[model samples]
Target: MESHTSVVLSLYRHGVTRENQEKIYIGWTDVPVAEEGIDLLMKTKANRPEAERVISSDLKRCVQSADYLFPEEKKIYHKGLREIHFGDWEGKKADELSKRKDFATWLEDPENMRPENGESFEEFSTRIQESWEMIREWCFQDGVKKIAIVSHGGPIRQLLTLLAPAEKPFWEWKPLHGQGITLYWQDAEAFRRGERCTSLSAVPIMEKENG
Candidate 1:
């Protein structure tokens, strides 16, 4: 029954790459953040004081977002938190890929589908779960009550789907761009149990035009 204190703040993908801006699926491309992406991170930090400590993926966009939002000394880069590698489809257009039978199956039940040459969804899920455990341990050891993580949409969605199962439609579980979810772990047992203090409202969505 011992109580432990920690918080998990997850940031969705930011800073659209040229491919992204072109509406392409730039999965696992290690693209850097766009100028507007830096602005978005700056604005987020200016509004959320709890985001003082940042853990980000080693990818360029994530690293750039972290560097812009947090002081250099306060940032930590974790490779385990990187995006799901999309293999041969790394920079393909989503619309074009969606027409493929395999892609349709992937969209229907991602758990069973593996993109050509890419890691399976199960593999990506396992890595993300491991990263979460590491973060939880670090937070407990350091008595950290709040922390921020900058990572890709795929991992963020995976975590959210695991943490907060949707009562409505399954599609509702997806995480939006630049959006975040705040999770509070009251104690070690509750943390282990995956209990949260409460779920906060979605991060205010920036206009798509602005993005």
Candidate 2:
């Protein structure tokens, strides 16, 4: 018998895109996954967990990844799950922005600085928190035991920093393209409270089939 209080949450980063390969800031840009990323995901699909529910960002990259990874599962898309809006920096690389004084200031205190026309880190985190609360409520209502979330690197990292059992900084929780982490919660109370999960494990990865 399944415990109603227990839930498994897997957070998968969308496959890499051309902008990712180019090391550009791609928040809210809506790019498709690259060929290389698709191939890699295809090879690893067998290892991904089967979930009762799948949630995803509405952005093109994450939506495409959910199709590749959870082909049979119906997905709930949320714009709030989207990556932080990079605003003026969208599609630009760090080196290109490095010369700007605003960029340097943002790097030092991103929580307080908003890229001209971009979302401040504080705003982004607040959006994510709301999205997460919604997801938890949905799980409770639907009696979901396992759930998968397909999102961008920034959003996934932010989630892990908040929920992973270990005490890791935001950047330290980075998940590679098409990869994810699984968090196990023994009680729904912790999930509802947005407390850290009791345990966590890396989602298994298999090498590309043709490689």
lDDT per model, in order? 0.68, 0.87
Write model 2 residue lDDT over 26-140, tens digit each, in one string. Answer: 8999899999889777765778877999999999999999999999989989999999998999989989999999999999988789998999898999999889988888787
For every candidate in turn, the CA RMSD to the true structure comes to 3.9, 1.9
What lDDT is reached at residue 196 by model 1?
46
The segments of candidate 1 whose C-alpha lies over 4 angstroms from its true place after superposition are 1-12, 95-99, 165-170, 186-189, 204-211
lDDT per residue (tens digit) for residues 1-211 in model 1 = 2364445454555555566677776666877777766666666555443564688888888787766656543888899988888888788888888778988898888778999899898898899988988886676566565677878777776666666534333346666554466654545556655554345445554433554
**Model 1 / residue 61 / CA error / Å:** 0.7
In model 1, the number of clashes is: 1
Residue 183 displacement in candidate 2 (angstroms): 0.6
Error of 1 at 191 (Å): 2.6
